[model samples]
Target: MVRVGIPRALLFYQYFPMWHAFFRALGAEVVTTPATTRATLAAGAARVVAETCLPVKIYCGHVLDLVGKADVVFVPSLRSLERDAHHCAKLLGLPDLVRAVVPEAPDVLDVDVDLEKGTLAFYRAIYAVGRRFTWNPLRVKRAAAIAWAAHLRYLDWLQRGAGEAEHDSETGWLNDWHRGLTNVAPLPITIAVVGHAYNLFDAYACHDVLRRLASLGVAVRTPTELPASATRAAIARLVGRAYWACEAELIGAAGCFLDDPAVDALVAVIAFGCAPDSVMMDVVQRYARATGKPVLMLPIDEHTGTAGVATRLEAFVDLLTRR
Candidate 1:
């Protein structure tokens, strides 16, 4: 049985179930890198150029961790997920980038996923990846169908607030959120943390920011909780289409929170060296200033300290509670 290594960073958080299901259906053992850690980040940073973003550095570290443990690593080249919306250049060339940085790692299976080119282009890409394990096209189709279904289910879960379920990591109790369809008793304050799915949900990356907010007796809302229609509606408020697809979602979520009276504050998590996020932050800050809503622009990098983030968050919450 050949083992396939999947990194926990980047696309893994977005499409883990789909990728896991697809690979499992093809009879391959799928192995995932553990959550990011200081050591992992260090390893990644050492291998990549200093100018690369933190997330990309973390991704390289994850691939390094998979070295000698798997037969091949799956690093797809994602150009665009939607029409007229492209991914960051780093993500588009991820597979090649990894190979260049980590030559000792096992073979990397690179697949191109550019939906803007047309559905058939995407299908052919999937077929190319699937053919590696089996020659049967029908088998690949079945696997793809199952993967798609699981992907939809995962999206539905996140959109419906189901992903807010019990988080078992540190501060789990604080982050456990309401279960069994129970509503949270009106908290004194409600905050919306807006960012990409990977950064917002990954406990290691953001140091469990959501859980920390919950611990402070504050209600927390995230972009994943918003439905597709709501995101689109939020995007409409902007003057033009966002260049990066994920940035659009973040921008849209920020707009939604700004317009909602129930949302007392907004925290925009900005990744260092990400150009789109840099631009998005400017827009969000400008909007926040115009609306007179308290907004915190939290910028994170490889050297970001958890204590610092917590201190800032504490101060922000303290000020809000005093009002």
Candidate 2:
């Protein structure tokens, strides 16, 4: 049986289920790199140039882990989802970048999904991938559909679980499913978590910080969970200049969270070598200074030890509690 390796980074959060199901349906064994670790980060940083972004460096590390373990490594080239809605340029060049860094890399697959061209164009990319594995279009379609359905269900489950936890806590059901999932007992402190989409959601890579924070009696809010319209309105309310779309969303969410007395502070998590995030973090620091709210900036790299992270987290929480 053919073996395929999928790096558990970047869009892995958004597409892992679908990718796993499709490959499994094709009778291929899929091996995923273990969650982001100090060793993995070091491997990636060693392989890439010093100037590469932190996320990219981490991705290279994952690819290196799969070098001799799989027949092919899937590195997608996602340009845009629609006209003007595009991913960072670095992400679109990932396939080539990985190849350049690792000359002997397993056959890296390039799948481009440019939705600005047309919705049908995205589907064609999917079909093309299916063709690469087998000639049977029917089987491909079935596998893709099954994978998509499973992915949707999983997302729904997460959302439902979050909601139920909130509801159960409100009703004083402390011994229920909600209680075991989070440390939201008594009065939970609200915390704003900011970062790129991929880094924020990957539990292993981010050291499961959100769950850890919850266990420490903190409730977490992500930018993705904020209402789009509300965030836009808040962005427009900015006193002076405009902000980047992603930064604006984060700032708006922070503003909203800060307005509520229940929220204690904000936590900004950025990958070690992320260029965009480095700039954003500077902006966020300035924002925090102006607003007089305590902001903790945590930079993550492969060599990051959870014990150190937990120590920092405890210090931050202690500061929040005092305030």
The candidate maximizing TM-score is 1
Writing each residue's lDDT as its tens digit, candidate 1 over 247-297 gives: 555788998889899999998877788877887788888888888889987
Candidate 2 Cα errors over 4 Å, as ranges: 162-181, 201-208, 223-262, 279-293, 302-312
Error of 2 at 138 (Å): 3.5
Cα error, residue 314 of model 1, in Å, equals 0.7
Model 2 TM-score?
0.77
**Cα deviation in Å at residue 306, candidate 2?**
5.7
Quote the RMSD, in angstroms, for model 2: 5.8
Root-mean-square deviation of each candidate, in angstroms?
3.2, 5.8
Which digits, one per residue and each the tens of the lDDT, describe model 2 over residues 1-323?
Answer: 77888997887765676688877876678778776777777888898778676678778888988989999999998776535545666887899898898888799878897877886777788888877778887888887888788666545544444345334211222113233443344554678777765676666567766667777777766665555555566545542333343544455666565555666788877787765566656656776777788888778766677898788888888877887
List pairs with backbone clashes in candidate 1: none
Residue 148: error of model 1 in Å? 0.4
